[model samples]
Target: MANTPHVYVEWRGGTCRVKWWTGEYHENGRKRYESKGGFTDEDTALQHGQDKLYEIRHGINVTNRDGSTPMTQWLDTWIDSISVDHLTLVSYKSLIENHIRPFFKRKSVAEIDVMMFRAFSKKVRSVLKERSADNVIMVFSMVMDDAVKAELRKASPVERKSRRGKYERRVKEKKRPMAIEAVDQLARNTECHLGPSGSSLIWTMAMTGMRPAELYGLRREYCWPAWPASDPDREQREESAERYGADNSMPAIRVEHQVQYVNSKLTLLPPKYQSYRTLVIPDFLASMLARLLASHESDWVFPALEGGSMGSVNFDYRYWRPAADGAEAHDGPRVAKPRPALPAVPSYAGKRLYLLRHGHKEWNDEDGHSRVAVEARQGHELPGVEGVYSNVTPLMERRIMETLQARWIGLQQSRWEGAVKIDSQLFPTG
Candidate 1:
């Protein structure tokens, strides 16, 4: 036997054999060794042994030499390492189990070449929408990246050009903002169907532009008729007033949490992007909310019928759909014939409820509010150092509230005028 550090070459019967320590332990507490030989030349056999020794020293697992670990096995380990919100984890699991594992489970990590990935992407695109396919590709890329880090693969086969090229050409549908008249009509119809609290809830969403989850998370304690002086930041009110042209004493709503359904349970989680913001409301909306609050005895401003947080599914079905679709109140009838369909609200038909928030942003943009102020109000952080230093001044808040007030009054007047015509036909007052 001729020996190097962790490699050896032996000559037997006119053939040279190379062997190296693989640096792995067996279950019986013995070190593992791998050998390959059939070289007529002793130097070539010794060189092969030296290369294997280098691989072992650099932490490469010889057991995975053929990349035999299935993609599904690696994915299980990858998923277990993830630390995120439960709902987010659920989403990841869904993407992996439903989309990824089905296609790649039996394939080894090394088997996923660029061509194979492109084919997988095409298959995903065929089944899912563009945005959804993009999301799956993103998660797949992440898993492949982890495989590279774990030394399961030499490098990730996910190429940016292959993943983004086709999807990037797919134009994202622009969200159309609702007209003020439509918003008012939606509110009136909600009032007609679900009464005053429902009307107020829709109006609050329109005025504040809060995310649906954030709106659901609003509690009685967070809704204020006037800014709370006991707040830790109360001392900044004077400076904030002078800076942003805000009254500082005006009513505001604290938006620190959002309602999320995790593990089939309603959970109060931090706002999106972890952005906590306080929104000042118009005087008219403040009065409307005040009336709304008087109707609820629970901590949640918009509690479910049985109490606790209101689920979006329940709100959409029981309240929003009927209002948006229009409904009629019947006197009394046992007739079995299908009742005449209520008139479809043409302005709001096929529209999502979140468009109200988009409409609010449109109002802000039309009013020429600063980018930082708009983003902050919308609970988005400005990019770069600007977000760090630029704060929403009191004056900015005051102006925002004032502008919203004007829009609200204008919408109300338009709605009232529209209602009078319908009322005259229904009541026929001389």
Candidate 2:
């Protein structure tokens, strides 16, 4: 990226010096230069200038502002410039602090190469499992790619597969999707612990495929359900539902934003990938939500048990884990009577909330519904022509509602261990 250099000789302070044009000029129209000094002789100084000219010409030593920076320093600079949501930004910073920075030490960014990265990868794999290491390495690769773009390195040291047949993908190990019956067990277990209200979050998430954050941030104004209300307000509820794109054919929940922690403070922001979407729910789910809402007075559709917004609270550990994995009764001198043991939902025993979303996808796949409709309902795009041309038909929406409602009815009929806990009524008896 440099141009031809002009070699020159000079003397200052009784010492020989060499100077050369660096293919740049100032705004004042004077050519900028790079120089070497204290050569102790004319020939030596002149030779130094000539050598620099060849180095610059061959692109071996073309002096520029973007020189090598320490790996840790470069990572800090790169992370600061990246645009990501606060939670994601926090995850990337953790990867850098725990894995990338410590291993690299004071090594310069330019010092890294494909071989060095491969070794670093092996180290990560040794410490962490294969999939987890891959996740950590992914963040590091993003930093290296930026370094290449900035001219700190000619190419990314992170070796990757060719973009063709048998292409490699990131290692993302997902838990098996929960079966519909198992989803019922998970919901019923929560019900057994905290009555019907506790189970609503479980059923809503499993059926609607709402992310935990989105569900936690759901507002009453956005979700208007009519069934199970002691006094129905059809006009007012429908008006509220219309604002978020609900209709007679398809009852929907609006996912406008999510609750998250930003700069150590709870905040509301757009959903992941900005996937602001309307998701259709079965009549049963809509009714169940109405019942849950009727019992609460907060603006949040789902408030914390302690009577406030569930903002950035670690619900997974305090609430979800106990319900999913089940807990043994604990009794000691500090307790009068031990609480009853929570029986684990076999399919969700070791899983998390994400698996419920996965379960939703599996249900759609099994129902033989339109791919485009399924993708749209799940807040995802199908990609290519399938995503652009295809649209969700009224028939597809009907089929979706029928299939989801069937699962709820099937649980009502099944004589499983947790079937007794399933709510006998959601929609009107009529």
**Best model per lDDT:** 1
What's the lDDT for residue 32 in model 2? 83
lDDT of 1 by residue, 289-366 (tens): 777778768777776656677654578777678767766653346753333334445556666777788878888999
lDDT for model 2: 0.74
RMSD of each: 5.7, 6.8
All candidates' lDDT scores?
0.75, 0.74
**Per-residue lDDT over 1-430 for candidate 2, one digit per residue giving the tens place of the 0 to 100 score:** 1222487777788897788887779999998888778888888788777776776777655353445588888988998899998778888989889999998877888878788899999999999987679889899899988887877776788978467788567657556555666676677667655456568878888887888888888877667553112113566456544543444346667677798877777788898878876667898988888788888787778777666556656777767788888888757789754555776665566677788887887898898988888788778888898788998766677788889999878766654433343223222111
Number of backbone-clashing residue pairs for each candidate, in the order shown = 6, 0
lDDT of 2 at 406: 93
- TM-score list, all predictions: 0.78, 0.77
